[model samples]
Target: MNFAPTPRTTSLRSPEKLRYDKATAYDVLDAAHICHLGYVHDGTPRVLPTAYARIDDRLYFHGSTGSRAFLSARDEGVEVCATVTIEDGIVFARSWFHHSVNYRCVMAHGRARLVQDPDRRLQALAAMIDTLADGRSADSRPPSAKELAQTAVLELALTEVSVKVRRGGPNDDAEDLSLPHWAGHLPLATVAGEPVPDTGIGVRPPPYLP
Candidate 1:
């Protein structure tokens, strides 16, 4: 809840609005199901989009045990930049040049580590379930020994992070204010649909879709 705001130094004129507070950042992290990960591997930059979850002050990621990134993370424990962005709307301005998008994004700097402890791995697995389905995490059965052997879990400590967001109507320059182009923001959002039962499921189930 008390993180410092790192100003956007890319622009001298119109800098981005930022929500760098730690609690706000966590809110955004929890809202997203996936994050784009950036790291250096084999002296080359790598960016991969993958599913993730959060627990306490650490972010959780899972991948194939043999995945190059996963292995690299476990072996070298290199610093990484994990980002999550969700576009909420399209900002239409009077001029075509002022087009912008309303979005929430978080960029974190941390070292990724493999979850070697069995108890911690189980906790990470449960956190992952809770992230996807609130109550289902408790309703689900614990993973068997065989199942545990087949999964890989990683934890990224949240020591340094930045959360930047933009939300509002179109922004146009003074000269383009009078342009006749259509102007305003077209709202965008993720809407949940009705839950569809599995092929073998016979009776109507409770709300399970999101």
Candidate 2:
């Protein structure tokens, strides 16, 4: 199913907000591993940092059936929000308060349900294993029915998602612009570390980090 971003009242920030369309949001979601999932239970708010993967227009997450959050979701089925954020660079200016960071964030709110199909659950599992670590899913043992039963899978249809972005130099106030100071942005990035191998493997990692 094709999904376009429909901004909810809670998800909208400013009128000039960056484009939160399907293509813009999915690009950020597909690149990140950890997502901050927010939901309400018993009139209280909760957020959990978890891993997620997008298969088509849906996002899938795994947890135990015994998990309090999923159990609550099963009963109440309130709106669910998941956000993926990537911090790309640091922004620095002459003024202290003007400092900021370059980032891309996507927040999605939708109906959440536990996916019970064995085949779909299997595919979601494969997605997680393949996404988190390379070559591990096919190399490791498959999931058994008992194991599957012990676990719970939730799917959030990507219907209403919003993306907000902050990039370029810091936002200095008009009065401070002519302070005759070096007001510019500082760059930041994450470099991939060299991969280490187990001695028993008797081989080195390929040119990739994974």
Candidate 3:
């Protein structure tokens, strides 16, 4: 399935990099652990980094009940944009103008609604834990009533979205190729480090620990 582009989703800057396919958008979102949630509060635009999870065609993010963003969205059902980006490499070119970075990003636009259903909220929370670390939700304790009460979960339908990707080396001018400067892309990635056990825990590390 492909998302029909709207005025907000159409990438006017780089039409070639713009993608309307749902699979591409979902792939970018699945590979990312965090997203930047953009919304307006008090007539001011605000962007906040948040942990999120995608289930089917919906994206879910949670925060403290006292959070201003959540509160505003819950009350007004404000339009929001959720974006996730994964940096793949740093492209270096002989000329600075041609230098760029390789990345995969997805932008989702929708109106966020507070998740009030207990079952749905639980599912979203569990999905979040599992998204961060697969199988971690089963290995850890579930949220208690008090904890659930203090948390605010918001859901945004994935009806409008776009994916953008850039890869390979920099596109340098033909004349600048022989400028005697090295030109190549430095690959980058995110990898897990050694697990550090808690001071009071004697349990063996779970298999899910990367």
Candidate 4:
């Protein structure tokens, strides 16, 4: 499915880099586990980094029930924007103006609703854990009643979404090519390091871990 861009989602700066396809948006979102959630609280704009999970066309994120952002969102049903970004490389150019970073980003806009249903909330929580590491939810203990009561799970549909991507080498002017400075992209990636088991657990590392 293709997402129809609203005035707020249209890419006025780099129209060519903007994507409206759901596949592109989902790819960017699923590739990253963290997202920045933006909302207004008491007339002040705020953005907080949080973990998220995507199931179908909906995105789920959770926070402490006492959190101001979550409380405000739950009470008011205010508009929110969730963005996920993955930086692939740094583009070095002959000139500072041409230097840029290669990245894939997706922005979703909607009003988050508090997940009140117990079964759905559990599923959302499981998704969040599994997104961090596949099969983790099954290995870990499920949330207790008190723990669930202290958490706030919210869902936002991916109805209004946009993706922007930048890749390859820098776009330097023809005259700048003659400069002595090297121009190339330094690729970056997020890699898993050696796993360190907890001191209390003697069990071997699970197969799900990298």
Candidate 5:
């Protein structure tokens, strides 16, 4: 489904880079485990980077129940903005002004609800664990009731969403393009290295680990 454009969802700066494709937005979001959550507390705006999991069209992020952000969303849903970005490369150009980073990103805006349902909360927690490794939720012990009580999960619907991407080399001016300077993009990616097991219990890592 394509997200309908809203005033907040439209990109005013780089309008050409804006996309409404929900599939592309989902891909960008799923590729990164961290999301910058923007919220307001006591009329002061704040942005916090936190781990999040996406299930269908909603996102779930958890934190200590006493956290200011969680507290702000507890009683009544709070307005929020969630963003995920994946850096693909560094764009090298003939001029410094044209240099930029190649990236895929998604921005979501909505009222974040504090999740209270037991089953939904458990599912969100499992999805979050599995994000680290395909079956990590199954390998690890489930959180105890006491532990769950101390945690708060916030849910945000992906209603006002926008995907923006910048790719290829930097946009060099026509005159600068002929200059004697190397212009190309240096590709980047996240690659997992050999797993270093923790102390005690000498068993190989599960196949789920890269």
Candidate 6:
């Protein structure tokens, strides 16, 4: 289904790159492990980089219970925006003006609320851990009651969202295409290195680690 763009979700720059489909938004969100959360702190706006996970149509993120941004979002129901970006390559062109990046990103706006239900909170926490590695939630120790009490899990609905993507080679002007400077895109990817274990040095890493 296509998400109807609200004023907040509209892209002013490079509107052609904006996508309204749910699949594109979910792909970008699920591929990235972290997101930038933008919210108002006191009278000033702030952006925080934090880990996140998506379950069905909800996005969940956690923080200290005393965090100001979380408190405002949960208690005051203030509007917040979360963004996830995956860079595919670095586009180099003949001219500096044409240099850009090939990337996929999603931006979502909503009023996040703290997950108060114990079962729901546990589900959110499990989903987050499992995102790091499939089946990881079952292998790791569950959070204790005291730890859960100190942690805050916030949920934001997957509405009012937009996905933007940039692909292909550099867009150099016709006149500059003949320049001697190299022109192309360098593909990028995130690769996981061998696991460095601490207390479980002799144990093999879980097969799920990618």
Q: List TM-score per model, in order.
A: 0.89, 0.84, 0.97, 0.97, 0.97, 0.96
Better candidate by TM-score, 2 or 4:
4
Per-residue lDDT over 125-198 for candidate 5, one digit per residue giving the tens place of the 0 to 100 score: 99999877889999999999999999999999988999999999889999898889899999999999878888
Model 4, 1-210: lDDT tens digits are: 899999979966889889999988998888899999999877888999999999998999999999987888776565889989999999999999999999999999999989899999999999999999999999999999999999999999889999999999989999999999999999999999878878897667889998
- Worst 10-residue lDDT window for candidate 1 reads 5-14
Q: What local distance difference test score does each model get?
A: 0.80, 0.78, 0.92, 0.92, 0.92, 0.90
On residues 10-87, what C-alpha lDDT tens digit does candidate 6 reach at each position? 866888999989999998888888999998877788999988899999999999988887777666566789999899
- Give candidate 3 misplaced runs (Cα > 4 Å): none
lDDT of 2 by residue, 91-201 (tens): 877689878788888888887788878899888888887776655678679888799888888899887877778889878888888887887776667566767668776
RMSD of each: 2.5, 2.8, 1.1, 1.1, 1.0, 1.2
The TM-score that candidate 3 achieves is: 0.97
**Alpha carbon deviation, residue 18, candidate 2 (Å):** 2.9
Query: Residue pairs in steric clash, candidate 5?
Result: none
Clash count for each candidate, listed in order shown: 0, 0, 0, 0, 0, 0
lDDT (10s digit) by residue, model 1, range 53-82: 888789988777777788776665757789
Candidate 1, residue 76: Cα displacement in angstroms equals 3.6
